[model samples]
Target chain A: MLEITDIVTSYGKIEALKGVSLSVAPGKITCLLGPNGAGKTTTMMTVAGLLKPRRGNIAFEERNITGRDPGHIVQSGIALVPENRLVFPDMTVHDNLRTGAYSRSDDEIEDDIARMFERFPRLHERQEQHAGTLSGGEQQMLAVARALMARPKLLLMDEPSLGLAPLIVEEIFRIIRDLNAEGTSIFLVEQNVHQALKVAHYFYLLEQGRVTFGGSPGDLEEDEVIQRAYLGSAEQT
Target chain B: MEFVDYLQAVTDGVMQGAYYALIGIGFTLIFGVMNKINLAYAAAAFGGAYASLGVAALIGTGDDFGLPPLIMFLVSAIAAGLFAWIVYTICFRFTPDHYELATLMATVGAFFLIEEIAVHSTAGEPMDFPEVLQGIVDDPMIEFSDAFAIRGDLLTIFLLALIAMGLLLMLLYRTKLGLATRAVAQQRTAAQLCGISVDRTNATTFIIAGVLGGLAGAMIGAAVGVLSPLLFVPLTVKGLIVTVIGGLGSIPGAIVAGLLVGGLENVFLALRGITERDMYVMLLLFLFLAFRPQGLFGKKAVRD
Candidate 1:
């Protein structure tokens, strides 16, 4: 489980995350839905230790991970699939995945890599190919698979479906569901509320760097303003 | 008749290029990993070579009661690597990452700092380096038509440079540390997201490059038969020239470009005077910049 309380993050003169808070329960997909510039990615980055917060705390399964080094945060079993699926372009797919397990010193790394190949067959097919050459959908899959190589207790996926085709979006949602079912907790930041609601057990709507609503899909559907803002159809939701 | 002389000059030029390649590879690695050129690199090279000279001077390189001839190279390499790490931490570590110019300017200052230290320490005088290829540079090792023979010392430098290049290539492609370094080079943020410490990788990269630089300095000292603070600025300029011609971050490009520049410089020196020689070299650099901005091996506008 992950818990964030009243965190504020900034870049130079501008504060991106201002007094924000959220929680992700264990073994569940917790989706954070927000519009552009709503501090969704910033929240994930702050929790992942990429961005330092000016105030507040982040607890990952009772350990206060706030202000920890990114490498230490990763070692503590949290892996982030960053926005744009920033896979190392010049690196081979296999090398990219290997880098994903950089913090692990266990003997099972090769085994895990083999397991990853099996889990993501497309990755296996192009394991030796450079990741930059991959299609956007393939790169997204590779990014997710790369993060899974870390064997994290919590997976932080930032905009996994952005710029992906519709069919690929479905595949991404399916993968998220499968990952959650396999007991890996996912804290996903997404703009696609409809597809997100289908896989997520709980969803939090973030607006202007603050959580406006937290509820189940059924509850979210009944909220008129939330449906209009995200789903774009108060009549259907 | 004159063609034979030109050919000999080019051959000799290629030998000189070997030294440039050694130092240029180090510069290329630093540029690749850190994305910031360390202007102090050649200074580090000079510093390392001088430190080795100090050791060699103290212990002597003779057979009895002295260190082995090759031990100085290793000593210089390790010392240079550590020295470079210290410089990296002090000069560039905490600088804002986005402002690459700031780091570049800081390194410019570091270059002066390192050069001044060398100058003050040695009283700005050229010191003779212990000859690596003993009793051979004046004599031809492999004679060809009397005019195109490979000088023993130059041949040795070329062979040593080739070996260094081979080892560097192996370390980069066939090792885990190299993997992390390449990852960091390609995408720093993505590398971090994967739990790879970009800072540590960048540091390791600098150390590796510094080791290479030290070897280059030692080789240059051995070849030129002298060590002087005056060699510092010129070597740094040559390195920058090599780095640019070889493509900004491309190692293979750097090596090839180094040899090209070396060959061209010698040809020009033989045909035109020394003044005209450098002008030709500068012109070649300009051509690469104006026409082929990507340089010899830069095939793509890859990095953002």
Candidate 2:
């Protein structure tokens, strides 16, 4: 449902993405694994239209959305849960979700918000509380729930498990899997390779702004070099 | 020497406070949304008064295309708002957002530009504004000590300001637009990620401030019976002083500080003299900056 062709993005003199390219099919959880400063977040931002690329194109469901404004891109069916879970700290949980559907003119915004609350009961409990007051896990949940309020065709999450406890990380992964199972295509960027490989239908390894490996998780699991680079100190099993 | 005199002074203090609150609220609102102070606000307020005077003159005369006094005031407000938007777009918006010094200098330039325009338009002469609340309540009998009294216009300005403040409070606390504005103010990048248009939000914020400033300007003109460019520069300084003493971005701080400044200034004028009155006010501002730089309601700065 999403296609990126050799997009190059940069900041001042430093180029973050040097002609990186990738794709995600419909209703699948595609994971991009990368180390620190591997331009993973840059790639996600470019796709979300936050940063304009200097070269190549980005297409969503056969429509070219390369240079559209971020607001227009989001309205056209792509929602990004930005890195670091940058929820509007001063706004209440409900307001943050309402802000997510800012472009929608539909009458069921309150219903959608209620549905999100039902999906995450923790969010309902803290609906009136300031988002910044939430715990890290709850804030991550709020960020993901906020993205879902946009009702996008694809959800792009950047390092949703960063700085979370192991149990909370597992819960986040489970939510990702459940959302994918419900036919919402997800492009997740993570450094947690073992857990990502277990859930990702297909995985790509990005290093130095290049996609070095792309295949099914089983194929990557079988490769010794890929396994060592990804697993690091942990056992590949 | 009498209870009536004390009551009259208090009544006058409240009226002056209303004017200060109106101007201070504009200053605070602009600073809250943009994080940049518009030093040109006082000048804009004076500019609105001039517009009101000109429009009212045209209406009172046999001009076929003139608007009524109320409609003229609203049009004057819109004109002032448009003028403010133009000034912001031209002066501040193009400059780097982080170079706050540059933004400050731009607003200073705008201040002088507005002052010069007012002077040139009126040929440095003060023009009288038509009484907005004439005959409605110009002479209300007061039962206070049989001597001291208050004008109907003073009461009207004070009551109207309170009403305006109530409306503003409702807008900020209850409206969706205000919620979006607050989000943008808190975090621009996060607000943009939520698909809130930053430019539109900022523009709306400026227009709102401009309208408030305009109303304050008209009331001041009515109270003083004349509008002049000379008043622009002093009002600008006083507004800035109020904003700083109240707190940078705190709405309630602005209201409380505005009244405090207004009451103190009048009390000093009553006891001492007008010449040394501003010295005490300036000293208070210095103390606020030197000690509690956060003023009343400002948040503690988070170190980066």
Candidate 3:
């Protein structure tokens, strides 16, 4: 479980996240939906320890983890599937996966690679090839598998389906649901409201630099503004 | 007779090219991993050679010294590697984020600072470099003609160059540390997310490149059979030129560029003499800058 409270993150003088507070329930798929520049990716990056917040307390499993280094946060059991799936382009698929487990000093590292191969067969097929050569969908898969290589309790996925095809989007959502079903807590930042609603038990709508709405998926579906913004029809009307 | 002379010059150039390539590789590795130009690199090479000379002098022909030149070479290389780590800590480690020009300027300062130290220490005088594996051959090596022969000392330098390159390739491709290094070079942020400390990886790279520079310095010292403060600026210039010709951040490019620069330097010296030799090399660098700024093997800058 992860809780972010009154967090304000910035780029120089411009504030990207303005006193934002949200909670991701344990073992649940909590989706954060917002328009571009709504600080969605900024929130994920801040939580991942890539950016330091000007004011905030981020607690994972009830221990404060804000302002920690990305490496420390990773070792604390949080892994990020970053926006645009930033896999190391020049490294081989196997090497990319190996790099994902860079923090882990366990004996099961090789076994984890074997497990990742089984989970992502396409990755295993092109294990020796550079990750730059992978298709967009496959690269996304590598990013997810790479993050999972850390064996994190909390997985932060930022815009995993951006620019992906509809079928691939469906595959991604299905994987998110399956992951949640297996008790891996997911905090997903998505633009695909309908697909996100399909998987997310809880949803939060962010607008500008603030959270505009937060509720269960059933409550979200019935809201007028959300329905109009996401679906063509407004249920309230 | 003229053709034979040209052939001999080319052969000599190629042999020395091996050492040039090693220095180029140093520049390439440091730049590729850290995106920081190490101007201290060649100076560190000279420093290593000088340090080895000191070790040899300390040994003073004792029977227990046990292959004095070989031990001297190893000490020189290890010292150079440590010197590189020192350069990284002082010149680069504490520098603030994203100051590429600042780091470059700092390393440039280090270049002069190190050269001055060597100059002061040795009083700007050339010292004799002991030969490695000498006196075994009855005569020099004859490749084809009497004009194209290599002396035993120069032959050791050539062989050492090839060995350094082979070991470098193995260290980069066949080790776990190499994987982290390649990841960092490809994508710094992503590598960080994977929990690889960018700073540690970069420091490790400097040590590796520094050791390579040491080997190169040893071979260079052996080839010239003399070490001098005068060699400092010229070696640094050659390394940079090789880096440019090889293509920025490309290992293979550095190798090819090193050989090209080495061979051309000799041919130019043979034709136009020492005073004009470096003038031509500088001109070649200018041509590459104007015509192919990316060098011979430039890869596009990595996008985030």
**Could you say which candidate leads in TM-score?**
1
Stronger candidate by DockQ (1 vs 2): 1
- The alpha-carbon lDDT assigned to residue B261 of candidate 2 equals 86
Tens-place lDDT digits, model 2, residues A140-187:
999999889889989999999999999999999999999998989999
Candidate 3: pairs in clash: B246-B253
As a TM-score, model 3 comes out at 0.92
Worst 10 residues of 2 chain A by lDDT: A228-237
Pairs of residues clashing in candidate 2: none
Give the alpha carbon lDDT tens digit for every residue of B149-192 in model 2.
66667777778788878888888768778877887877676677
Model 2, runs deviating above 4 Å: A222-237, B1-10, B62-72, B138-143, B146-150, B302-304
- Candidate 2's TM-score reads 0.92
Error of 3 at A174 (Å): 1.8
Candidate 3, A149-191: lDDT as tens digits: 9999999999999899999888888888888888899999987
Tell how far residue B56 is off in model 1, in angstroms. 1.3
- Candidate 3, residues B1-304, lDDT tens digits: the string is 3987877777788788888898999999999988879998999887888888777667676433334566777888898898889889988999875888878888888888888998898898887786665654665565665566665666677777788888888877887798888888888888888888889999999999888898888888777878888988889889999999889888889888988888888899999999999999999999999998899998645566
